[model samples]
Target: MNLEELLKSIIHQENELYNLYKLGETFATYELPSMVEHFKWLAGEELRHKRTIESFLEEDTLKGTAVIDYLDSLSLEPYFKDERAEPADLEDLILEALIREKHSYELYDRLSQILSGSLSDIFKMMRQEELKHAYRLKILYEMIGE
Candidate 1:
């Protein structure tokens, strides 16, 4: 895959993550105050990721080389495992987010090894951020006793 294709894939994944975070935020709002705040923070992080990917594309640094269809076929199921399972409470939501973040981190970390230049750095940074988010969610889950 070329740089442009890789960047586009990254952007697409970021958008997906943003949507999930929004859903999580909605779920969190109906729960305890602490959870509401935690989900909101996660949503903000997703937005930041979206902006970063957009900025990278806008710089014209990524060259489109690979076919879009082929890249799109890459399955993201592992990152979105709970898309079908409805969360029962704030703790459930936190656990779901933690799982998603961990999957994202693994995916991006693997992708980073194959990519080079700015795209590699971007993926590495995203993976790191996801790890942090996972850690935060884990802590929240423990605090909520679930």
Candidate 2:
């Protein structure tokens, strides 16, 4: 894909993720009250990601040949995972969110490798944020399971 296409695709994915997290937040509000705030935070983060990717469409630097080459070569298959079922319980909900976060982290990790300079650094930072999200979810899971 070209630079514009890639950015649009990423923005779409981010919006989808934001919806997923929002769903989780809604579910948690009644069934898993302890997790409501966490899900809200995750949803906000996803919205931020969507906006950031959208901003890339206006940046001339992202249209460079090297960036386009990386975009064309990037495999987005793993970035699009299967639709998650409604969680039956708190554990299920947390696991679903954790899995999505891990998937995002892996995608950013690979993007960081293929892109150059500041773009690579941006992905790296996003990857780290994903990792941190996963870690926080894991901790919450352990705490609630106790």
- Top candidate by lDDT: 2
What does candidate 1's lDDT look like per residue over 1-146, in tens digits?
55565566666666666666667667666655557667677888888987887886788644452223344554545653435445666666666667767877977786566567767887899889999998887787777764
TM values, all candidates: 0.69, 0.83
Candidate number of the best TM-score: 2
Stretch of 10 with least lDDT, candidate 1: 61-70
Per-structure clash totals for the candidates: 0, 0
Candidate 2 stretches with Cα past 4 Å from truth are 81-89
Candidate 1 runs further than 4 Å off: 1-13, 56-60, 64-77, 80-85
Q: Candidate 2, 55: how far from true, in Å?
A: 0.1
The lDDT of model 2 is 0.77
Model 2 deviation from the true structure expressed as Cα RMSD, one decimal place: 2.2
Clashing pairs in 2: none
Error of 2 at 23 (Å): 1.5
lDDT of 2 by residue, 1-146 (tens): 66677677777777777777777777777776788888789889889888877877876547654666666456676666537447776677778778778778887888788788888998899999988889888987886766
